[model samples]
Target: MYEWSETDLMIREAVRGFIDKEIRPNLDALESGEMPPYPIIRTLFAEFGIDTMAADGVEKMLATQRARESGTDSGGAGSGSGSGGGLEGQDSLMAVVISELSGACMGLVSALGVSIGLGATTIMSRGTLAQKERWLPGIVTMEKVAAWAITEPDSGSDAFGGMRTYVRRDGDDYILNGRKTFITNGPHADVLIVYAKLDEGAAAGADGADAVPARRDRKVLTFVLEKGMDGLTQSAPFKKMGLHSSPTGELFFDDVRLGRDRLLGETEEHRGGDGRESAKSSFTAERIGVATMALGIIEECHRLCVDYSRERTLWGQEIGRFQLIQLKLAKMEVARMNVRNMVFNSIERARAGKPLSLAEASAMKLYSSEAATDVAMDAVQLFGGNGYMAEYRVEQLARDAKSLMIYAGSNEIQVTHIAKGLLGR
Candidate 1:
């Protein structure tokens, strides 16, 4: 049984209060493909300092301690050890805050997820002191928004295997060339964490360049690609089945030149070498971020369905009274609890400075994403005709839920990851 501290409770209440006051009323406006007023997001950040809470002075103390032991600083807040203590308590708080904020609106939550988890994580975990000094402050302060560019036109699940994007070293610059598809926040991101092959031959030689590698190989490298860089172009937003407000689009990099500093990790010593170790590390963090986002969306779907069932009625009784409806609700509850527990447990392990096996992360992502899809579909069924119509929120839930299965390493890809992790190469 996971216990919540007073601080955790307070954070949850505060975030939920802000959501109730600021976001819920504006749901209609946001749902119509209109951006949620920036002032609202700004107000929450200003009043609560949401972005920095997980990185602030006290939080930093804890994170540093945890990072020292874990050899990686991946958990957001309270994962660190400090004089203040209560690391586990802090993890619960962070989760509650994320869940509440996400429950209000997934677009906002996803934006934060990418910006904080991926955007800041790249610099925090891999950047040099200078790079951290330059990027971390902005990300921590919410001054810059970050997006990840890994999924290419034909490289959804097979991203690393078929990654055609190439970065060629040219003295002090690396020229990047490629196209990324289905990029979340592509239209508005200020920074991009891109993965590309620095040397295709090295990658292939290391056995990390194929979807079904012959060995336990690693070679792909990642970079912190910034916006407005030369050769970085964004396309008009693509029409999507869901998350219309999230603004998915394409990123084109043609002869994009970046300073050597943009290269994330050890480059000189590992030149012409497989970046398998680095790639595995990065993927581990990314999988956690993806799982958290999926969990948030699924929780929301469950909440909405439960709310609808209780309120809507037929034949003088709540529709929830029906046996079939009750069964659907029951299954949703069980799935929701299962996925939530998995996510929270994973976060705890991460906070405790424990190594999370790739199989565990992949399994969690696969289960939660599929759970979200199933719950959303059931929600649509519960809403009957209303669920199919955009007028009702269930349809939107269903739409956004599908993307969960497709993105962040599709469920199919996750299955492969799990199998690989379990099969010993």
Candidate 2:
């Protein structure tokens, strides 16, 4: 039942205009990895006045928190609303920005999403007021980039349980040692949210060395690391299958000494929960985000294919006359409609403060991602030789769509989560 309001359409048109002038002209440079997304993202924030708005929002949220701490908080003044103290009643606007940018260059959207949605959002939800003040201002304003590091080489699916990256308690500090891979913005992030297992060492184990807990059983702790910290190495961007503009890479922490201040919440046990619980709480939102991205991909491919079908001719008639081509177009339209509806439903739920459960989010991710990938591939087939070439752009969309299937917990993992939700396990 939800639809884009007049204001939402106006913002979408503005975003599309920006994309035409800024993103499409540099698509080659962006897709080739010759250009990083940060500069363009920063420019976007400044052009849209997002920087000033984010700064004001953070100041207000922080003021509200301070007032609450001092027991002088009024019910309304300076109070932050909406999920995670973000702009209230602006979820649709945010979604429009994300989807529009995604349609033009998904890589840019990926970089922006991970930096704010996962990285800054985590700190906002879990970090102390001091931590939020120190990091949120720069991050929300796009002055600094942030990365959320959780995936590891051996622990692709089992992020926490199989995590090898760990920190051992030191004298009022923690010695961190481990490596993380496939980290978005890892190569250039100014701030990082790193998750590690808490290794208390053999001394704390019961019955000496025999009682030491297995590595998988250790407590998970979260920390914030800066760009140039000692013993920390951020690798050059990896050559990826798609999303070259996003700059995925690896991070190695070798005896990286972290003070208690670097630990999120400045405590091992956060008031909300431990690091594992904190990380799990983000899964639903992140998966729901995949639907929005998928919707973008689907819409772009559908638009391009429809235009192509009308123009291209064979047997002295337009290709749109062919049933086979029409089938592809029809299927693409179906996908676009379904994904758009899912995104709209999510926006409405967010506005109502009734978020979807993890299982529901997973279902959206699975269906929308598959639909996008299918639609993109079909677009490629419809274009025939043109689609195979990079110049046609369908190849890029296909590659980008494929990455959606693998990224954000993978379709295989989504199936398991959906089952768990259904069985109530």
Candidate 3:
């Protein structure tokens, strides 16, 4: 029963038009690693006025916060509709953009989400007004690319417990040392959000002096670093199975020095558990938004499958007559329906002042991601030999869809989170 308003429909059309005009023609170059995604993304921002939209949205949020501080709202806590009205619409518009672009290139949306959703969001939420003013404008406008680095060589699933990076206080600055791998946008990110454990300067340190403080009791701290900082080395992009448009790489910080201002929030309060909580909350948003990407993948795969089934004749009859081909088409339709409903439901709930809990977000991610992977594979199967070839698009989609289950915490981890939340409740 969920449906887009007329305004939402127009937005979808605009996004699709841009993707067709600027993206599909260049898919070969993008996929072959001959071109980077940032330039295309910047062009999209300009052509669609996404920069202006983002700026207006930011100002609206600030105005609402000011009113809250001044007690100018006669209606009270939930009185001003600005927060609910503007925010919900933004979320919907975001979903539309993600879904449409995903249909064309998953890598584009993946890169976009990390910079704006993860990078800008972290500073905006945890940083002070000064920090936000200094860093946010460039990122929000796509003028500068950003990367969020939390996953280390040792920390993939158990991000907190498995983290090996550590930051220690050194006179008026902090010394950071660690190696982080599989960082999105790392190779060329103008801004980097790095997470490491705070060192208490205890006797036990690295280099066999003691053991690098194996306490495992330290707090996780987040710091913002620029690309050319001293002792900070960024590796070249890694060859990946898919998402060629997105350049993934490694980061190395060898005694990189940082000041208090670099620490998010410019305070020590971020340690202990506040920083961890903030990252987890960001994960929930990221996970919930996965539904939109999955929905797009499902719709695209189903569309291709349905069309193929009708035109692809076998044994002197259309494959659509074959029950086997028909089954795949049916299942794809079901997945498309289920995912679309979840997406619209989330939008409606947000508009009504209801935000999903962590467990709910995990559930959506789990189901939607699996569905996307399934649908993409089925589309490949429906195409038989053609589906497996790069010319068919579904081949790329299959690889891209697989990443959904792995990133943002694997689907396996999501199950445990959902269970823990249920048991706690």
User: Pick by TM-score: which candidate is best?
Assistant: 2
Residue 81, model 2, lDDT: 25
lDDT of 3 by residue, 1-425 (tens): 56987888999999888988999999999988788999999998888778877766666655655576577845444322232212336777778889999989989888998998888888877775567667877888888899999998777898887788889899878999998998899999999999888878664365563453464557888899998999999999999987788889999999999998898878878542557887987898889878899998998898888888889988999999999888889899999999999999888887787878889899999999999999999999999999989998999999989888987889999999899889995
Assess candidate 3 and give its TM-score to the true structure: 0.92
Taking the candidates one at a time, how many backbone clashes does each contain?
6, 0, 1
User: Number of clashing pairs, model 3?
Assistant: 1
Tens digits of lDDT, candidate 2, 18-94: 89999999999999888899999998988887788878888888888888778888757744322343545568888
Q: Positional deviation of 153 in candidate 3, in angstroms?
A: 1.0
Q: Rate the local accuracy (lDDT) of all candidates.
A: 0.69, 0.88, 0.84
| Candidate 1 local lDDT, 18-43, one digit each (tens) | 88888878877776657543345557
Overall local distance difference test of candidate 3: 0.84
Residue 203, candidate 2: how far off, in angstroms?
Answer: 9.3
Candidate 2 worst ten-residue window by lDDT:
78-87
- Cα deviation at 69, candidate 3, in Å, is 8.6
Which residue pairs show backbone clashes in model 1?
62-80, 62-81, 63-80, 218-276, 219-275, 219-276
TM-score per candidate, in order? Answer: 0.83, 0.96, 0.92
**Deviation from truth (RMSD, Å), model 3:** 3.2
